[model samples]
Target: MRYLFAEYVFDTDRRELHRGADVVSVAPQVFDLIDYLIRNRERVVSKDDLIKTIWNGRSVSDAALTTRLNAARVAIGDSGDEQRFIKTLQRKGFRFVGAVREAKEPAEAIVADDQVEVQKVDLALPDRPSIAVLPFENMSGEPEQEYFAEGMVEEIITALSRFKSLFVIARHSTFTFKGKAVDIKEIGRRLGVRYVLEGSVRKASGKVRIAGQLIDAVTGAHLWAERFERDLADVFALQDEVAVAVVSAIQPKMIQTEIEVATRRRPENLTAYDLFLRSMQQYYLTTRESLAEAIRLAHCALDLDPRFGSAAALAGDCHASNVALGYTNDPQFDRKEAVRLARLALRIGDDDPDILSRVAVILAGMVGDSEAEIELADRAVALNPNSWRTWNNRGWVYTMAGLPEEAILSFERAIRMSPVDPLLHMTFLGIAHALIALRRFDEAIVALKRALRHNPSFLPACRGLASAFAHLGRDVEARAAAARVLEIDPSFTISAHIARSPKSPKLFIEGLRKAGLPE
Candidate 1:
């Protein structure tokens, strides 16, 4: 039988695989592994199964198996990061996830290899903003300056990629047009990007100049342009300056333009980073289904790259958030998983501010208030004060530490840092919590209302509204809010909620009782 998938034809009888006209070379073991995976595609294939079948029960180290699997992926235009063909399930096993069609006869019988052609892998744009940064022109006329010019473009690409909202073509793709006089439109179309960033770097007389312009490839209109010059000693600083300027300038313009960017949305073909971004978007939706989907996608990303601290942290956050929002039936299991994943993320990315903040938040929420958590959050914010997530996590640490005033201030800073963040609801909820702790019932209600505006079905906001209304002697509204909470989270009970939030104000608990919530 011949199996066909993603422009690749695998002829089992011939023991060969062909991608369009190209025959993909695979080691004997790797080929067997692929064959096993494809045959067992209906179910996950365990390591033992592979070792028993492919190796005839011979002992194989974990690393050896991983290398073989990676080789198999590469031979088929798949990758560990994308896992488009083979998927790894944590603690379960591996499975072939690609869509495949079967051919009873050999593929060579239908068409010759020379007549076959594969569609470009990146022919379609992603469902978000996408851009490509071409290599900066090295105008210095010195070969030594080439690295610096290339480095500047790389720096900008890295910074822009961190935004998660933007789809950045890899350096390998954009560098192909390095010395070529390619039109911006051609570059965009070839790269499947809506925007193209072109720049020039010149170094002379102990100084360096870097100029960059962002252009809408569709219309060939320059969206934004800036130039910076600095001492040679400050080249790294200049790179950072240019990156920050481009990031700050481009995002707002993309938002204002409301660029209808995507041409194709292939959820199954998402890379690890793409899956992470999708998980984050689901997380920001703040719904029970969304949170569950977020965890699933994060797990897939984690499986693709076990060392991906961001994916582990995101999965941990989802587990913690489920408990926080009363979306969990098994709190103990969720709590354990949340703490374990947080620590894993910490071990992998202790120095990353985003990971530190994420771990800190998970620890604080799942493990309760701790001095270590406060320090972690503070360090994260100190490392990246510009990140609203770091500031938001700092706020959470303080809230759990019983510093309501300080927590409120930190939350306010987070809001200012990202005024239009999709995660705004969580920040607003943090403010509400701090205000409630301070006995500022009216202000707390306003903050809770704002949170509900972002996520109408947010159980925590509904619960907060119940307490705030009860405190204000608005019995009807209090009961209504309490009902909403139960509607959103059927498992919500006063005692369970109080146990989860040990730091809840006594009045808040009393109000829950007054609002007729289950004891």
Candidate 2:
């Protein structure tokens, strides 16, 4: 793909930049950075977003990024003072203001045409287990309750989506099967998924009922099934409970599901719990107003039963989301409340993987409780080995504890479980970081490239790639990579990433400096 902007033409496929008749020789890394900027010229990219995209969440410094950006500007006849084409945002990132035009057919179309003969290539199925959540049928006579039933299916989808080890179809695409009587095999083929979840919901006489079954769509085998009944007042709670149960039942190795079903009994009155569960569905959507509404509904459930650990944990999740997403003005206050509620939930019923996993995330991210977080994450994984979140959390703990190799393994497991997951890109970044720590520059570059394939905007991957190039004496490519990072985050300093890193600062800095980062 070639992006024509002003008088300059950037050939992404060839990794070349052209100015009219002159071939402007730019380093491959610089070419990549310019290509990304031109491609994403529509919006102001943020630092975190860039890091996530370019680096795959690997650790890099602000100085490295700045040095590269300066070099890129020099290449383009643009300067920090002139600010003609690429404009840098203070806390945000960068924006390419030049008008861009494609110089060739779309890359997708070309690739499709070239690979048309190989399109029918059949590959072996992955060794990992996979499943999909089908839309639940609405047994309620009222069409207004469609949202309620849809909400139930959506909740299951979200919960399952968190399990990176599971291949779940997106809710938007999966819900298309609603109100249709389709073959499970057909659904699997259409979605490129292995398992399908089918269920029905019926509300009658102030009582709610739900039945769900998991099917191995390819083999046409019914892997798991369950039915639940609850008062209409607690319908929401029942839905959440059922979702958790269904997740457990589908995973052959999760024995805790049986224990939970055998020992934990539902509350006598389900009304408030139902409302809370429904509200949680809203909360998971991750909108500001929705989070507030979720909190309100969760509080209502607590009013009915202050001892409801699930509801309280969810409430804490709401606050944490609010704070994490920058929705709340006072993160400190929200963080404190989130920790308090999460702790309360753990105290009430810490054994539940759902509750423990939630608490573990809060403790690790918000409270910095490494020991407790690792323990909780370990327990969560022990309870549900197929859980993506469990592995993600474990990887997170390892990263923070400076155990990059362990973190890389955990992330690799997570990626194997959910190859298409956006977050799995971070695992690739983790691998690169570990490789870099072990002084394997070539391996780090390879891993970073893999991560960039998943998310082109990942800045950490870009930085790591630059470090590798620098260490290998590929100054031009290293500078270009560093420039791309700077274009995404001007304040990005290699020193800072090393300082904040959980690993040994001296060793981290030594490696980065050797990789060509300016002091």
Candidate 3:
């Protein structure tokens, strides 16, 4: 690849330089350094970026990088004294100043076999476009609360995933770089994403504090950031409050992005409501113990304000979790309680997307009412088209209904809206299942691999991959994959589980059988 400058050409493939027909030979490292500079010519290429990219994350002395840069300058017919080709910023990085143009290509076609690349969808970038919600750092100094922080990120991921107009990265992909110091541009390239959100969370002395910032990944520029401090007594309100603020911040940034007047209504006071937000955060933990705490806090929120739609919705969510996780001995009683709370939430906040979505999840997942679930999900999406969770929930409904193609599109849209959510690995699994049903075995395998890349422990993805390989006549790999799935969830019985869902189609079962599952 030749990067063009006014009179100079940096040939990446040839590892050579050309200045108006004159060949300039430079050290390999020097050529790489020059090429890097030219490719990112519009902005400053920080030393950290150069070291990471050029050295492949290896440690290299700053003096060595400086030497190669100087050598590059000389080869380009520029002197350090004149400083015309490259400009070094004080305490920052380097920039290429010269204009570039392409040189001649050698007509040799060299193809490598081991390179497997997925073709990206060709879609127009939406106005006020992309975003990333970074994992909120746990400032509470309690490592155990890492789940709390992670839960917050997940909620944000779900909330944002609803927006069809915004592009969001899957949470699993973003969290892969968690705790590591990374350059924003590199994140953009690796994830093929454009925006990033970073933040920190602190809980101490009965209060929770959160600080967050949104950045343009391509330019490493800060677009928005804010800090919120609230009492832990109102913890359940935190996620929704934060989500609302984020949605507010993102709208103005999007091209022709307008916020609806009806959606802008705010509670008179949020002190009690804040506790509800914090409680809802705990609810997403989806564990037996956490559900107890979530239910307790949600009731406390109702005590504060019976009309609080968010708290009511969270109460419903807690109940749904109990049934989903098999926490209750009486499935019928548990489901009744879930349906009751969900219906109450809908009655109180029928127009609220978050509440509508919670009710829809219960209807689809617990009640097995796909038609009603789809109706609610569609309404929620229409109300808050920017919420990723809404789309994700809709995808689940489609999958349960055996509409794999519709499910695949819904999941894809959810990923585009909030690509960084950890649960998105399941979305990939859903896509694989859909592809298998469509008899597109190769595409199914690719989607499964992508799911594994995001979450190696995702059992559904493992099962899907095994089934895909088996269908493709790769029995050994298929058996190995199925074995892994069984290891993860020993009680996993494909036939029994499929039978439980009335909407499971014969086509889907056939595809799974071809993939190697035992009848």
Cα-based lDDT at residue 95, candidate 3: 75
Whichever of 1 and 2 has more lDDT, that candidate is: 1
Tens digits of lDDT, candidate 1, 1-519: 887764567878889887655677888888899999999887878889999999999999999889999999888766665455686765667889665667775465533444322322323444456788889999989998888888788887776655434566666557757787888886666556778888898888888887888898878999888888788886777777667666656665553343122113465666776677777777777677988998998999888878677889989999988788777777888889999999998887676778889999899887775899999999888766556788899998898788889999999988766676677889999999899889999999999999989878778888889998998999999999999988877777888876665556687789899898999
User: CA lDDT of each candidate?
Assistant: 0.78, 0.65, 0.66
Which candidate has the top score in lDDT? 1
Please list the Cα RMSD from the true structure of every candidate, rounded to 1 decimal place.
9.7, 27.1, 25.1
Sorting all predicted structures by lDDT, with the top scorer first, yields 1, 3, 2
Higher-ranked by TM-score: 1 or 3? 1
- Relative to the true structure, candidate 2 reaches a TM of 0.40
Model 2, 496: alpha-carbon shift in Å?
5.0
Give per-residue CA lDDT, model 3, range 299-357, as digits (tens). 88788767566677778777765654335455567677778888877876575676787
Worst lDDT run of 10 residues, candidate 2, spans 115-124
What's the count of clashing pairs in each model shown? 0, 30, 48
**Which lDDT value does model 1 have at 429?**
93
